[model samples]
Target chain A: MPLMFDHVYYTYDASSPLPSKAIEDIHFTLNEPFFCGIIGQTGSGKSTLVQQINALLRPTQGKVIVGEFVVDSSKKKMKEIKSLRKYAGLVFQFAEYQLFEETVLKDVSFGPKNFKENEEVAVEKAKKALKKVGIPEEYFSKSPFELSGGEKRRVAIAGLLAMEPQILILDEPTAGLDPKGAQEILALFYDLYQNGTSILLITHDMNVVLKYCTSVMVLHQGKLLGMYSPLDVFYQKELLSEAEIDAPDLICLVEQMEKKGFSLNRQNIRDIESFVAEIKKMKGEVK
Target chain B: MKALPIGRYTNYDTFLNRLDARFKLLAMILFMVVVFIHFGSRAMDFTFYGLLMVMVLVFMRIAHIRIRQLLRAIKPMWFMMIFLLIINVLVVQTGEAFYIGDFPIHYDALFNTLYTFVRLILMLAFSLILTATTKPMDLTYALEWYLHPLTFIKVPVHIIAMVISLALRFIPTLLEEADRFMKAQASRGVDFENGKLREKVRAIISLIIPLFVSAIQRSTDLADAMEVRGYDPNGKRTRYRIMHFAKRDVLSLFFLLAFFGGMLALSICGIDFYAFIL
Candidate 1:
């Protein structure tokens, strides 16, 4: 089902004397499966926005609609909150810490079992997910706590993947991972996105957005600035600075090259490989 | 998460806020002792206790603690207070009894319940005042000073103080971490709110294990950072902010001492000041 946020707002400690608005009037809709990147500075409400998708945090005002499930502030308790969570798997930041099961396989199977999948089916889904994330069969029986940091993170992601959620939301999943591990994790998500699962990634890295995201949402001070295509977002230098986000290095390099009297096509140049190919084509045309 | 009423130090410029932390801690203990002093059957004893309760409220006002904070401080104990009232009314059936649909509510039971309830509220309010006025580091220093005598017997007061300060320091951090862990597990479809008793227990285990793992991880990181910064718990440490009792503190202590002595004497002699007035 299409995911939609109809003028959603979230306030921390709404009943307290000192209430803080975390996100304000956030409106968005995803009609189809797509890789979307949510970029914001710290305390800019990116995490708060994604949390409403799975009903982990109900909006203080307005409603979040995920397929058939609805979480509205007016409702005291939403009967379909658990089902909504099953549809949208959220991989938290530092998810490795959440690994508490005795074995890696059992840890990954925890999510599916929670959603009421039988023992054999849960283990099967968990094993498939672990393999998809590239964890070895040998590590399945080992204690999750004994695994390396990267392995633990993969197993955590595998835990979510076992549930086979339609919409996969990750909050800075690559945070604290080494560069190679981060890229591998991002590529894994990209593969899932290609396989038809909608991906919503919250990240501070502009490069990841440029490389993987089809569309980008910029949040500033608890408000949605706008959602634009990756190229459109990078093209607006003023908006980037306004949101306190740096343009990806590739974009900056392309801008510098264009400034020096070189007429190069910037529309399709998303990564270093494409930029290099564009330069080569330009050199040939000049000759 | 609801704001915890205790240990929430509000920054305000007032006599109690500026009072030495040592004196504030000592005053809190003395106030609690006075609150627990047994009252006789005379109305004068109850009247004196009521006056002491009023004095605590006055101190709370002087410290700039708002009425909202006082209510919040007492909010968590409300269920216990009601339970206490019910138990007292049921068990202490003495004096004149008023029947309410076959349930005999004794006059003495009501009086005893009121006394205990008032005492609890006064104790909580005064402690809240002490905590709200005193800075945490200063409180730790005061605690170290209190435990100074233990150092003579080879107890490491400095280490104990350091441990208390560190625990206080990480309270917020741990709370934030716990919130994060709860959300994470909730996202995984661990239904914490609506579940059978067995399922709820399992959900809590899920939340708790993650919290415990992360807490241990944080403590290790903290220990490493402290070691890197040359924190030797057993080593002698120089004081930065030394506390000195001011004239106001000395005067307040004398007033408290005189009040305690008068109340003690009245209780011992069974004097009925209200009866004399009548």
Candidate 2:
């Protein structure tokens, strides 16, 4: 399913005395099966932009189109909002805090049940999601609160997965996790994307964007600077500095090498391993 | 939810905002009493209440509060105001009566309802002035000072004041957290706005449970933080902010006392100002 935002503008507390524009003139479209990263500093409207995808927040102006559902500012009510929610699942930051059911299976099934799946089907979907996240069957019946921090986060993600959303929007999914744990969670999402799920990841880490994202959208002070390929975004030092975004260390290293008269192919460097291989190939050519 | 006007402090460099909060709190209580005063005569009551309304409005102006804010403060009481009107019309049947169809509407009932509504508005406006002008920390210090006398009776005034301050401080934080949780659950397909009663209850449970868990966790974290900073609930703490009663506060107190005494005299003298108007 394709997701599109048309001239979307959102203001928090619009009727209040101190209205603030959280996102302004945000226009973007995501074709299916694309792993896109949204990068900005804190309070740059990344979360506000994603919330409109599933109609958690209606735009103050313009509209958001998600597949067949439309959330427009002119309309006060939409019947397809619930369906839209089921089609686009949002995993909040520290999502594990949202888990409250007595058992892990029940917690995971909550989303499917809310979407009107029958009890048996909901339980089955929940079990499948749990297994997909690698939770053992024996732990399915245990209290979700009994799980460790990482396991609870996985369970929370499983809760959303049970809804079978085509577009998964995660806001800082790896925040506050150990390095290995964060890598494991990102790998799981990458695997899902590999099997044809569209992923929208909101992150402050530029390295994560270069490593995992096909394209990246830059937001600066609630405005979309532009959307570009990951390599293009990383190569523009002026745009990165203007947006107050730090270039990933790999890109910085490659730039330093180029300044010292060493020719390096920026296109071939996406991750540390690939960048290392590129350097070795350069050495071989020089020899 | 939009930020409620009550308990929200707006920063402004107005005269009322600069006044001591202890005096402000006392003046607020005195104003409330003044609003509740009745002269037992329609003309006197109307005239006195009208004057009090003007005074309250002037106070709001001095505090740099706009009409929009005053309306916002009264918005939440609309349901209760309507309920009060309905109850008065139904239960109190006195004075001249007229029938609309079979139902009889009494003149006294309507008059009483109007008076009650005006009183309520005046009370709310007074409170709005107090809260909008004073900072939360200053309010707590004033409360602690007032409750200092209770320490002689073995009350934990310092602890009570601390609790109140913390509660005030966390109101916005908790509200923001609740909003985030609601959105998270909504993304999972919990339709909070439209659902049957059972479904609504279930939806609310989904929200409340998460909120409750997060609240507890937050409090635990806060407790740990306070402990790490060596916050001793029973220890003697020196005052960081010492409040002094200024000349303006003294003048305001005298004015309040004079107004209260004059109202008491009118109530006792039984002078029917309505008869004089006639």
Candidate 3:
């Protein structure tokens, strides 16, 4: 399903004495299943922009179009909203803290049951999602809190996945995890994206964006600076610095290599391993 | 929604804001007692209470607190104030009857209702002034100092102070957590606001269950963090913030004492002369 944000704007505590502008004039469109990364510093409205996908937050000004669903400032039907939420599953930061069911299976099935699904179908979906996320069956009957930090996070993501959303929006899914745990979660997301699920990752970690994102959208102070391919975004040092965001590690390595007069092809360097292979290829071509 | 106005201390250099917390607490208690006594006495004119309202507004202005914030602070009590007025007007039926449509209104009840409304409003305004001008840590320390006498009766004054301060610290954190829980559940198709009574209750339960779990986890983590930081419930510790009562605090105390002292003299010396003016 396609996701589109048209001139979207949001204000926190709108009627309060001090209304804060969270996002302003945010315009973007994702018509295909592309791995998109939203990069920004803290309080840059990255989370606010993605929450509009599932109608968790209605835009104060313009509309957010998620395939057939439309979320605007106007009133929305509960059924329409429920369906939209089912279509676009949003995994919030520290989502493991939200787990409350007795067992992992029950917690993972919560989303499906909320959508009015039958018990058998919900359980089947839950089992499939749990298996897809690589959670063992032995741990299914255990309390969600009994699991380790990474396992608990995976269970939380599986809960959203059980609803079978077409577009998966994650806000810092790997936050507060160990390095290995972070990579494990990001690998799962990359696998999911490879299977044609449109993924929108809200992250500040530039390395994550370089390794996983096909396109990058940069936000600074609630304004969209630019949305372009990752390579194009990598070249815009002034824009990146203005947003107070760092370029990806691989991009920095490639820049350093070019500065040293090693003419490595930057466009082909997406990850560390690929960048290394490109350097070796350049060495071979030089020979 | 506007956030709850607790812990909203303005950082302006004002006499009220800079007054020692202990003096502020003592003055507030004494002033409230005098106001309540005046309310019960029925000797002073209603205009005296009006003057008190003006005085509070003046205090707020001197403290650099906006009139908008004062109104917002009292906005939550409008319904309760109106309810008190209605109950007072409907129940007290001893004075001369006045017609309002078909219902007869007692003159004594009307006067009593006005008096009670003003008293309640004054109480709220005084509290707003206290909370707006005082910092949370200062209030906690002032509370500990006020309750220090309870230590003789084994009331664990230090522990009580610690708990109060921790509770104040967690209010904003818990609010943020609850908001996150609500949005997370909302993303899972839980419609909290627009549903049937039963559905809404179910949605609320969904929110509360997660919030409860998270709150417990937060408390446990806080306990661990505090332990790691060498926090002890029974340990002798020095305060980080030392407060000294300065000349401004003395001036505020004098102002409060004079105002309440004059109110007391008026209440006692009225001799029914002010009732004819009302």
The complex in candidate 3 yields a DockQ of: 0.60
TM-score of chain A of 2: 0.96
Candidate 2 lDDT score at position A143: 95
Tell me the native contact fraction for each prediction: 0.76, 0.82, 0.71
Give the per-residue lDDT of model 3 (tens digit) for A7-38: 99999878654589999999988876889999
| Candidate with best DockQ | 2
Candidates, ranked, lDDT: 2, 1, 3
Winner by TM-score: 2
Error of 2 at B267 (Å): 2.5
The deviation in Å at residue A161 for candidate 2 is 1.3
lDDT of 1: 0.87
DockQ per candidate: 0.73, 0.78, 0.60
Highest lDDT against the true fold, candidate: 2
The candidate, 1 or 2, that scores higher on lDDT is 2
What candidate 2 gets wrong by more than 4 Å, as runs, is A259-262, A279-287, B3-7, B82-116
How many backbone clashes can be found in candidate 1?
A: 0
Q: Please provide, for model 2 over A209-271, each residue's C-alpha lDDT reduced to its tens digit, 9 standing for 90 to 100.
A: 999999999999999999999988988988988899999888889889999999988888999
Share of native interface contacts present in candidate 1: 0.76
